[model samples]
Target: MCTAPGSRAFLEVGGRHYRRCEHCHCTFVRPDQRPSAEAELAEYRRHHNDAQDPGYRRHLAQLATPLLQRLPPAQSGLDYGCGPGPALAGMLREAGHAVALYDPFFQPDAGALAQRYDFITCTEVAEHFHHPADEFLRLNRLLRPGGWLGLMTRFQTDDARFAQWHYRRDPTHVVFYREATLRWLAEHHGWACEIPAPNVALMYKPVL
Candidate 1:
């Protein structure tokens, strides 16, 4: 998000207040309502993500297939925010790419952050960001020029469905992005963005 001051109250769901950023149109939960590190880690650990799971692989393919199609052979990539099971990293590795994993709770490797990558995959991770501005800045710094930054997260389309939306119900999901929000991010960061699949966005950094 654009870090602009003064966001209007967007919604109130289950005692948590949501605010809309005037600059980026991105919606985020109030800081006071956000889950603590311990609570967030506990919620994440409850997920059963297996690298070998076929269904999970297929779900991840929504982002991976498009990204794989665009990547050059044997490129170096980073699976940013890869959870307890880095299935997406394994998928990328199977396609002959060198992949590094980084997750604050599960695989916190500072060395990985020091290096740049040809591509970065952030699947279902952006929503958990407490400070999206800083997170996106880190992602931009981690990618080489002309590199790809692929993301997968459910888009907030209809306000009517927001109250009952399953994606926002998760305590860990604090931020929500719309198509416009993604486009704003691309323009602000000097990247070309495209939506190749539902809930999937592919952004390419310009070669300087």
Candidate 2:
């Protein structure tokens, strides 16, 4: 009953019950098992996410490199779910792209959500989606024609490894995506999808 019928497949990982979607191949924590909003926000606040961190910049560069290559100069972008530090937005700005920041707990700039962008970056953020389908639609609507959406998250490989996957151990990370799941999302929204790097995907919305 998550997102739609035929989307939830139940399983037990380390005695924790999880659900996998046949439609999109996204694994998810059960609603009751999810952490409280305050707890989730507190965890986010604990992240260093420092703009000056070389290692963190390199991690963001994984998505930024490809996305920058595809975009023309002076393009505007939104760093969706840009947590407390919002280093990604600063990186994009440093490259001369006009960037906006939005995070439910951090930036909380609702007006940013009301605007469209030439591209949107959701790096390391998709798994936090409570309503993946709805959030996807919102991102789609936020993009200008022929815009792109860049995402970076670990893709679910298979059932066996999923049991021991370190990414799943995070309480805030609920929905999980497979490569096929990203493809399905692209097809669902009539966008072009490409994997420019490992654990990174770029989805392009066609111009009218």
Candidate 3:
């Protein structure tokens, strides 16, 4: 099995090998089994992404649309993993919420984490996290009470299609979350979660 330091090895369902962290229970595709960082970066660069891409504009609106409905008129947010261009951030700003952009590869602002937000978004990004359990908790901690977390990623739909699901073909996609898995996560982390669409979810912090 492919095991990284501090990450435990788990079962391989189909051709994918898994590593389960004892502390996190995140069944991840082990590092040695994954594509090289350079290869992954090259693949990411292949995305026809630009701030001016109109299709990209409407795509970002999917997250902004739900987030706008949930948040107050002028709430602040952070678009975590905003990719090479902060389209989601721009969309949120247009919706009237101030948004800060942070991407590990692009913006890389450490200071952004210091500021809490009314909501946080991780569009098409969570499955790429190296430490999802920790990161998911961090996303939780970053939100103020009654705040929301909007995530856009394809849900693990069916075991029958596990081999053929187009989303799984992405080399950078390491973790796959089922609806029940997200539910368990929501309950585990003390948030109210819902998969409003097949590809999106909204998690609201518990109001005390």
Candidate 4:
């Protein structure tokens, strides 16, 4: 959805036009310009997604560190969009939590989606959502009461800066979210939201 209410084209990246939702300040590439499934999968495969990669582990720790602290012993979680390596699942498993993995491309375990979780993580994945509102609502439904949803996408700061942002270069990165957009999500879904670190957010489902 275009951000400006009137829904005007905002920017053209590599000849692909994008739209911003002014009300929510969310930006997204037009549907017709989106990459094919094969291309997107190929792009993902290019990433160094090895779980044993020390640098990758450190980057995931940005979310895992805080999440591990909040989870009690033996809680179960799901690493939604865990990608090829699923290092975050490995990390949480090491912390004494039972973790299930789901990735549409690499680990498309349908049974994982059938299960609910005490907490769920979607690091560096939310931006790839083609239908963010629906996907987010689905994620919320997957949680148990008082469950956590940790995310690690870079937030869009402003329009002027968006044109030059490095994160937008990825063709699969469709939707962009702002801090205010996230806060609106919290208010809309009745989840308590917190941003403990840069490009990271923790949303808590109500205990009820």
Give the number of the best model, judged by lDDT: 1
Per-residue C-alpha lDDT of model 4 across residues 87-177, encoded as one tens digit per residue = 9999999889999999889888999989899999999999998878888888988999989999999988878877778899888999888
- Reference-based lDDT, each prediction: 0.95, 0.88, 0.78, 0.87
For candidate 3, what is the TM-score?
Answer: 0.85
Compared with the true structure, what per-residue lDDT tens digits does model 3 show for residues 1-208? 1122586555666667766554434456875677676876787889748877898888877777877877888998999988897788887887788998888777789999989989999998988876677888788888889899999988775656665778777888888776666777788778998776677889999779
Give TM per candidate. Answer: 0.98, 0.95, 0.85, 0.94
Please give the range of 10 consecutive residues that has the lowest summed lDDT in model 2: 1-10
Candidate 3, which segments miss by more than 4 Å at Cα?
1-15, 18-27
The residue-level lDDT of candidate 3 at 208 comes to 91
Better of 1 and 4 by TM-score: 1
- Please identify model 2 stretches exceeding 4 Å from their true place: none
Candidates in order: C-alpha RMSD to true structure: 0.7, 1.5, 4.0, 1.8
Top TM-score prediction, candidate number: 1
Q: What is the lDDT of residue 126 in candidate 2?
A: 91
Q: What is the lDDT of residue 148 in candidate 3?
A: 92
